[model samples]
Target: MKFERLPFIMKNLIRYQATMKENDWNKGFDLLRSIEFQEGVYKTGPMFFSMEPAENEPRYRNFEFFMPVNFQVEGE
Candidate 1:
């Protein structure tokens, strides 16, 4: 799902948590994902781009990112 540009504090927290063990990192990530999910899935925010656009349209373009609901089994 699309996420708003995380605030500096939140970003720092996430980065710090990511440095932990694998299971711990997963737990933190899962918690963040759940919070985002509960807040309504879709969001629109600024993202950085390095390429020069042919026309001026805010350096970033609006993007629609979504999270898959569930995993599918083979031959479901």
Candidate 2:
């Protein structure tokens, strides 16, 4: 198999982090949308998601969700 590396592009994003089990993975996303709605923010690009084993809780994972916005949000 062959693969090519893609260059990293810098982006401004609103980030939300949470720890939860796989069954509740969408919770973070829902919360992020709620915040976006409350703040009148719109997504400008794809949503980014990352996860790793939660500290001291093997059943859960620490997740970070990122939403790229059209412009930088103040007081972030």
Candidate 3:
């Protein structure tokens, strides 16, 4: 993640968790709805893994600016 986006991500995470703690189900859902978790693609062979924003969700499309390049090392 980029340094600039880190704060926003962290703040959202904390707020989301806090809402959950306060039994604010609606707010928590809203927070989750606004946040997007995207999967990162590593260009090493055919390996794949789950990403945060989910494939179809677009709330995080703006945050796509923070997508990291897939760097792979030899032998896992």
Pull out the clashing pairs in model 2: none
40 Cα displacement, candidate 2 (Å):
1.3
What TM-scores do the predictions have?
0.26, 0.79, 0.21
Residue lDDT tens for model 3, 1-76: 6555344221112112221222223453443334332222322222121224434544432111121224422210
Question: Top TM-score: which candidate number?
Answer: 2
Instruction: Tell me how far the alpha carbon of residue 50 in candidate 1 is from the true structure, in angstroms, after superposition.
Output: 25
Model 1 TM-score (2 dp):
0.26
- Alpha carbon deviation, residue 70, candidate 3 (Å): 15
Per-residue alpha-carbon lDDT of model 1 for 1-76, expressed as tens digits? 9888865421211111222322232454455456445644432332221222223454433222222323211210
Once superposed on the true structure, which residue ranges of model 3 sit more than 4 Å away at CA? Answer: 1-15, 19-23, 37-76
Error of 2 at 18 (Å): 1.2
lDDT-better candidate, 2 vs 3? 2
- Ordered list by TM-score, greatest first: 2, 1, 3
Error of 3 at 47 (Å): 26
Report the C-alpha displacement of residue 44, candidate 3, in angstroms.
22
TM-score winner, 1 or 3: 1
CA-only RMSD, every prediction: 17.3, 2.2, 15.4
The whole-model C-alpha lDDT of candidate 3 against the native structure comes to 0.27
lDDT of 1: 0.32
